[model samples]
Target: MAGERDGETLKRRGLMLVLSSPSGAGKTTISRALLQEDHNLVMSVSATTRPPRPGEIEGKDYFFVEPVDFNLMINRGELLEHAKVFNHYYGTPKGPVDAALAEGRDVLFDIDWQGTQQLAHKARADLVSVFILPPSTAALEQRLKTRAQDSAEVIASRMSKAAEEISHWSEYDYVVVNDDLERCLAEVKAILTAERVRRTRRIGLIDFVSGLRQGY
Candidate 1:
């Protein structure tokens, strides 16, 4: 439906669809679901100084780089946003994102509040940010424990940080509570569908309207 046409084909400028949430709040799950369903949406692969895990392909999972190279990219303004987490640097490369948007392909960003703020400051018109929240703090903690990926100490740290993360909910354009996964996914999809058709986003609407006027 994104490139659908009634008379003259309508073209839209691709938007940066950002989904940010504290750990275990369902942002990753929702992002995966959206990418699977939407052919035009692609995840923005980031460059990281961290080593890849088993079966992780370079340029696919991430562009694994050396710390020196990462620093060079940052210095050269090639990175759209960069952050240090747990002694590793991760960043979004500006080139790929710019190319994707220019070609009318939406780029999905699974980043934090810091990255979202940086993106908003750089490209406010092209950004559509959503913050996901858990139904309750208890639920959030449970979800983190169920993953079993972290130690109790790490989980505790994450739970402590979640509150501070949730405090930034007002900064996002939309907020969805992940009480029910299916319902939340549907609501997010609806938001994307509506955003795609917005008059301002549809870049070709003016030309289409002009054609109609000429016919009249």
Candidate 2:
């Protein structure tokens, strides 16, 4: 939505904002905050083989599907990216994302490095990726424990995997070390604000400028 106030309005193409992080790195928290604040951004609803949990809505929370259907989608190239986690298949449906992009509505993705890599391959021009890192390993472990949603064994497993996930930091366009939640969220919002105005992303800037030249 960033634009200059020339004679005409500048239109911008939508972007795919991706946030990736190791478990307990605060990417989810940041994503949630961004969604709450940004009315123009929508979360990419993924399809999953897992059944809906309590209070979860179909199509909004996820497009609940059978494993066979998920595989069919993968085979037909209907998915932007698909991954198996904990024996459940999760993927982003290409149709909705494409529609949103064509309408100039930004799509936000809370996915891992693997999914991000797939999206980059398919739509690198529209993708703006950020990697979130915890301030320290101990802080990461502490945040995992504080959640209390996972067992000690699961927390330990996630901690073990955290190092490998952090290694992919170099793949991201921007990296934010989450020492403080508010500060990190502000940094991410700043990144999105700046990227929104990038010359290449602004779709009709050339025409707007041309119109300005004619006026002079």
Candidate 3:
């Protein structure tokens, strides 16, 4: 298959693209847009102890493991990052992500700041984290209401949590205020494209340059 650039297929290590945001800040929507558009990117399926809600599939949405099995995974060091949120355990399994990276396919993480930190600690070179922010607190609250995914009580709780989540914006490599969806998405794609061509990630460049020197 052709690589990121057209025609020439130069090998490069894949990246871990992390998009984090408060519940109503549009990270999930941005993530979905990225996955739909980028063939090289795949979402990292997480294992969670939380029960599946309406229209959620077993392996696709989440692994949906029992708490016992999740603990076992933690003990075995099979999870890259694990955290308890809203009384349920959620974690990223290590195996699939590793395989995808090795094959030059980027893995996208729709995880929190805590999980982003863990991934960075484990593989700093491969991680490119972006924190998405809403335009305003009132806009964020309205978005939660518009989505109608959560009850009024739940939306209130999320609004309370948004401030804390937004505080971690400095931790990410890039920050995007998602006031305009198209602009935000374009900026994200620009970031990804630039990161892909960085010298460290382009391992095949060594051989390509060597060939050029020989020809000269």
Candidate 4:
């Protein structure tokens, strides 16, 4: 918690830190770095139809589900946000996210602009959205190509999409240019520190302050 602390009391609400970017913009890497650095934060694991890669465990990387089950979640309003990506439906399940926030734990999101917008509308008070941009178009193209799975055509498609995605940068509370990974991570860490200290999140502060004044 980043706010004022009186005596040995705990205050402050949990935060939803959303990091959004186009495919090659390094949001995922930055999110992982943030999690490693902060013990109080955890990544919001998404449920997807996408298959797990070689080393990824079922629940650890993502909650792999069949299309029917995913649609069931969507229909039942069990998903906080859902979107179709590259023919697969992916979403954040409402249960775990709600439970984590209620426990005063910060949750991180690596999602697209659409998902970000949904989260904002659903939990505006708890949301802190950040958009990440690569230094240049050429750099973004190169980064996309670095992945062997994507063809040149796919990379080009992603690059084109990146332009559209970056246009929504104004919607976010913070924008970070990922020219260097370490420096970008440091900036994100600072934002988290500042958000934790926000007065609205610290619900226990007023009572704590009053007790302090009374010399309790």
Candidate 5:
């Protein structure tokens, strides 16, 4: 879609952009930067059965619900996609994402490969999934340790799981190596920009083109 302007016509359909990567591979950092720079992009808030991490906020970082409540949401069909990771339930709420898509606003998801697959099966047309990779295992481990959020044991566990997470990279539409954070962010933004204007995603394209032809 063209850049947003006041009173602009020719509305464009929005998309669901999923960014999946192993823990501490910079998906979250890239997501934060993308949201900061793109006014049209909105973050998808997931409800999780896990306790809040430091500096995490309710309704922003996550919904932070009990396991029973999370299960209830699942049984009630409130989640667009739900998955269990490390014995905790995490899910994307369906209502908010549907509302954002209806309003022609893009929803950015920082989820796992499982959630991405679920969304693809549900709404593949609106989905643009990207898998971010670390430059190397050593680099990935270093980045995880640098974040200081996890203990040695937790870091080791994450490192062990990274291989399995990365094995699903082929399922994504795009794969970016996060050797340089800024460059990776730029590449992800480029993909978003190109996808937004795809012929199928724009509404009323045939009519708009016909009107233009008549003007000649």
Candidate 6:
């Protein structure tokens, strides 16, 4: 549909922008930048069975929970999507995401391809999935190694998993090869703008246009 200036015909629905990438592909950094720049966007805090890292806040970095509690959420259908990664269960809760979308706010999900798939199936209309890839496999390995948090063995494991993760690129709606973070962030912002202005999202446009015809 064409752009309508009428107030009643330009209402927007909430959007779910899922960013999927390998462990070292920079989705976390890009997602944070997007949240900082976009006032209407909120990051979806995942519930995890893993312990919080040193400086990581409980409700901010993740909703740290026991394994049993994580399993309970999965069984209760409280999580929009849940997956086991590196021996820890991570999931996006249903309540907050639904509430945010209902309020016409966008929720940013930093998750893997598996979680993205589940979110797509659950919130098919609201989702705008994006996959991020490193500029090259060599760059990906270098990035993983530069992170001092992992040991040599762990880094190798992550590098191995990266290949499998990159294989799912075709499943997502959009793809960004993150050679330059700033340019990638700009592209992401453009995608969000376009998705928000999509015809189906502006439900009130029809009525506003109708009113305009009477005035004309």
Best of the candidates, lDDT? 2
C-alpha RMSD values across all candidates: 2.5, 2.5, 2.9, 3.1, 3.1, 3.2
lDDT tens string, model 3, 1-216?
223332253677899999999998898889989999999999999999999999999878899999999999999999999899889999999999999988888999988989999998988999999999999999999999999889999999999988888998999999999999999999999999999888898766776677667872
> Number of clashing residue pairs in every model?
0, 0, 0, 2, 1, 2
Tell me the tens digit of each residue's lDDT in model 1 across 21-42.
9999999899999999999999
**All models: lDDT?**
0.91, 0.92, 0.91, 0.87, 0.91, 0.89
Superposition error at 2 for model 5 (Å): 14
TM-score of 3: 0.90
TM-score of 1: 0.93
Which residue pairs overlap in candidate 2's backbone? none
Please give, for residues 101-121, the per-residue lDDT of candidate 4 as tens digits: 877899998887889999988
Candidate 5 segments exceeding 4 Å error: 1-9, 50-58, 64-69
Alpha-carbon lDDT of model 1: 0.91
Question: What lDDT score goes with residue 21 in model 1?
Answer: 92
Q: Model 6, range 70-121, lDDT digits (tens) per residue? A: 8899889999999887799889989988998888899998888888889888
TM-scores, all models, native as reference: 0.93, 0.93, 0.90, 0.88, 0.87, 0.87
lDDT of 5 by residue, 1-216 (tens): 334421254678899999999998999899989989899999999999999999999998899999999989989989989988779988999998988887899999988888889999888999999999999999999998899899999999999999999999999999999999989999999999999999888787777777567872
Q: Judge candidate 4 against the unseen true structure and give its global Cα lDDT, from 0 to 1.
A: 0.87
The TM-score that candidate 2 achieves is: 0.93
